[model samples]
Target: MASSGQFAIVTGASTGIGLELARCCADEGFDLLIAADEPEIERAAASLRADGAKVEAVQADLSTSEGVEKLYAAAKGRPVDALLANAGRGLGHAFLDQDLADIRRLINTNVMGTVELIHKVGNQMRSRNAGRILITGSIAGFTPGSFQAVYNASKSFLNSFSFALREELKDTKITVTCLMPGATETDFFRRADMMDTKVGTEKKDDAGDVARQGFQAMMDGESDVVTGMKNKLQTTIANVMPAETLAKQHRKMAEPGTAKD
Candidate 1:
């Protein structure tokens, strides 16, 4: 069990990688406060409780400042020992063809809200001189997402932001680790409306494995991690490849109807 009185906050904990990360924290014996935009968050809390960890679930849209405050308010002034800022939304299609509201929501949830929560909790941790943060970025951030333009751009922001934050806190006890996972077995593809794309239809990494890799990296204070071997290779190649080439490759995988080819 983890040391008594440790508390962790995991966003997007109702499902997918977020849920798995919460479970890992619980297994380590940390009391948890998890949040998601959907009602399923309560169910996720119930399941975590069965594992003997103290769990609190909050259902709030993390896309707005009001919702972020609601989730933070649930912390009740406890010092967060670990934070997994994993809440994110995806949008897939030609950028211009996507709904304006969706694009704003995607930016708000993926960039604004995530950064705001980090700023809030991160300051508290800094004052206390201790904390660990694991942010879920994406391998997609390395390339230009032709169909998933906004989502990829948001992740690129996170990927860059995490590194800069880590450097800023280098002398402090706070550690910020970015977890970049490639296509994963999650509802992200379906929710993003990309199930008709080749990338969406391709084989994906297991959520459990990705979560474990991220959890372990954060614990070890690693700067960043790419979950799967294939993903790591892709990241390596992306760094050396021309930007236009990467964009073309992404278009082939993400363009609608490519899955049917």
Candidate 2:
């Protein structure tokens, strides 16, 4: 059985869905370790603290090894009852037009950072014999993106990693969940400079609702949870459609000059 002091670490908890997830966990009376690259992390920490959650805020870039190491060090000696590996960003425009540094950061944060954090915390959870992990994957992973190519590919890797890791730890008490959401209202699009794109400005689902679904599914030990009916339908269509067709459909939404929506 887990103790009352058990901790839940949520990366990217400064805003958007990650912030909502942190609030959700705190509402359930769990201590929190919230990480973000922004100064807003302190504001989030303060809010959670005021709400009676014992919160620790760490402002570190999750796109680098040093940043991830900082978070791991902060979590040492604490029993991680739950972990939300939710830190991520998106990119827009032609892949060739993007700066090499930006591309590297996207890959590092979405792929390498997630993999390393999961590997470490996952082992600790297994050792403790009880834990739950919720990874943020995107609906874009199901199809090949044109302008947003690298971001989608990174999410595809995350989707695969979460599912495979879940199977590998099936005998243990630790639970792993992958959350797949599509076109949620978030700073992601704005940050990616993709607000003009269809996926960015089109009518979107709320981040809070999406986070709630994932949080509930994590508690239930579900392997994967797709939020919103439209998103579910999209996932279903992606499963049945040919890769070439899906990629073509995505180009209209993701390509810079196209505006099919």
- Candidate maximizing TM-score: 1
Q: Compose the digit string of candidate 1's lDDT tens values, residues 171-209.
A: 999999999999999999999999999989999999999
189, model 1: CA deviation in Å? 0.3
lDDT of 2 at 127: 85
* Model 2 worst lDDT run, 10 consecutive residues: 252-261
CA lDDT, candidate 2, residue 43: 99
Which regions of candidate 1 deviate over 4 angstroms? 1-3
- Estimate the lDDT of model 2: 0.90
Q: After superposition, how far is residue 168 of candidate 1 from its true place, in Å?
A: 0.4
Error of 1 at 87 (Å): 0.2
Give the clashing pairs for model 2: none
Best by lDDT: 1
In order, how many clashes per candidate? 0, 0
TM-scores of all predicted structures: 0.98, 0.96
